[model samples]
Target: MEKKTDVMSIRVNEKIKEKISKEADSKNMTVNTLVNQIITNHVEEGTVFQDLDFTSVRKQLLKKLFNSMPKEEVTKMAGTMCKEFFKDTTMYLYGKYDLESTVRTLESWFNSSNIPFKEIKSEDSIKMVIRHRLGSNWAMYFETMIKAVLEELEVKTDSYVKTIDSFSFRAYY
Candidate 1:
């Protein structure tokens, strides 16, 4: 079934309207479609990001920082800080933190961070692969962080793999 939508009218500055029109044309979409996308994104993901006080940082800076940290320290930080971050963000976003919510939150985080990932699901397990160019330390951090989060959710992970630019793991619920 098609979802129902309500129509509302709002006034915008002429310059802003022109810019929106230009952007819509550039994207080969109608202004209405683009506006709906903007509203939906704001309501769904932007609000969560705002509430969580998320900030954007340059990828180069992040790569440098990750590279500078010792592997042991990176692992420890990921296990501790990233675990807490995932737990809290999942709870805040979903009102409850579980395997499903945590997975959803992680996907959203990856998307917002502009990271590429693939998730394959079966009846009893999920396999996630994240590809990046931030080196082995970043992969290690992700592996450790994912393990910590899954441990908190009481999910067992196996088939773990980490390379210089990618990480993958299979989690069984």
Candidate 2:
């Protein structure tokens, strides 16, 4: 027995159709096959990955490792580095990963550091809202420490950190 291919017509913008055609050609697939595969994927599986929370894994693993290390040493090193790295910026420790403990450790490490905000975790990723007092360089340094600490923890996770502008919705009046 052979499955019959039924002819279906769909209207789409010319530009979109052109782009789809190009992509299909690049992948060496016919338009019909590509569309069928997309539909089949949606129907068969809801998503590609099952359970992968990179952000939480990173935070948890780092928190564990840092907690294990001697607090005084990390604090001394961080304090010395902070003088050269961030002089005027207030470090706002944000994220759902153990805020109280992490803040305490960081405060102990850096004498002048301040924790202004903490983001609660509901789903997966953690968002830190650090004020721009330290400027972009300070933010970059903080981001570097975040990655280094997470890497040192050796957690099997992947993450994406980005700085985004305020999001707003507009309506036509």
Candidate 3:
């Protein structure tokens, strides 16, 4: 079904308008479509970063930090730091903490962090693969963080795979 939309007019600087028009033409889309996409993204996902007070870190710095930490320390920090934060953020964003909200929140964070991820859904479970170049310690950190969130939500993990540059898991809902 098509979504309903409303029409409104707003003014922009002439140069900004020209840039946006050029970008829209280059992308083979109308100005209206590009503007709608930008607004939708801000409303649906960008607010999370704004409201959560997220900070940007260089990948090399994060890589060094993660690599220096012991595996056990990485696991402990990931669990302790992410569990309640994830739960609270999910609740605040979606009005409840469930698998769908959790997954959506994760996707938003991955997107904002410039991490590539793939999600596959089936009748009974959802599988996610996060490909990050931050190394095995980072993978361990993500695995622990995700596992903590799943445990808090009472979800069961069917399988988990971790490597130097990627982490994948299947969770039964």
Cα lDDT, all candidates? 0.88, 0.42, 0.89
TM-score of 3: 0.82
Highest TM-score scorer: 3
Score every model by TM-score: 0.79, 0.29, 0.82
- lDDT for each residue of candidate 1 in 1-173, tens digit (9 for 90 to 100): 99998989999999999999999999999999999988876787877897899988887888899999999999999999888988889988889988888888878888778888999999999998888778888888988888888887788889998898888899887
lDDT of candidate 3 over 1-173, digit per residue (tens): 99888898999999999999999999999999999988887888787688888888999999999999999999888899777787788887888888999998888888888899999999999999999989999999888888889997899996799889899999887
Residue range 4-107, candidate 2, lDDT tens digits: 88877899899988988998999999998888876654443223112211122333454455455565655555445543232212122222333233433333
Candidate number that wins on lDDT, 2 or 3:
3
Q: Model 2 segments beyond 4 Å from truth?
A: 1-112, 123-125, 156-173
RMSD (Cα, Å) of model 2: 19.8
Q: How does model 2 fare in lDDT?
A: 0.42
Ordered list by TM-score, greatest first: 3, 1, 2
**Residue 89 local lDDT, model 2:** 22
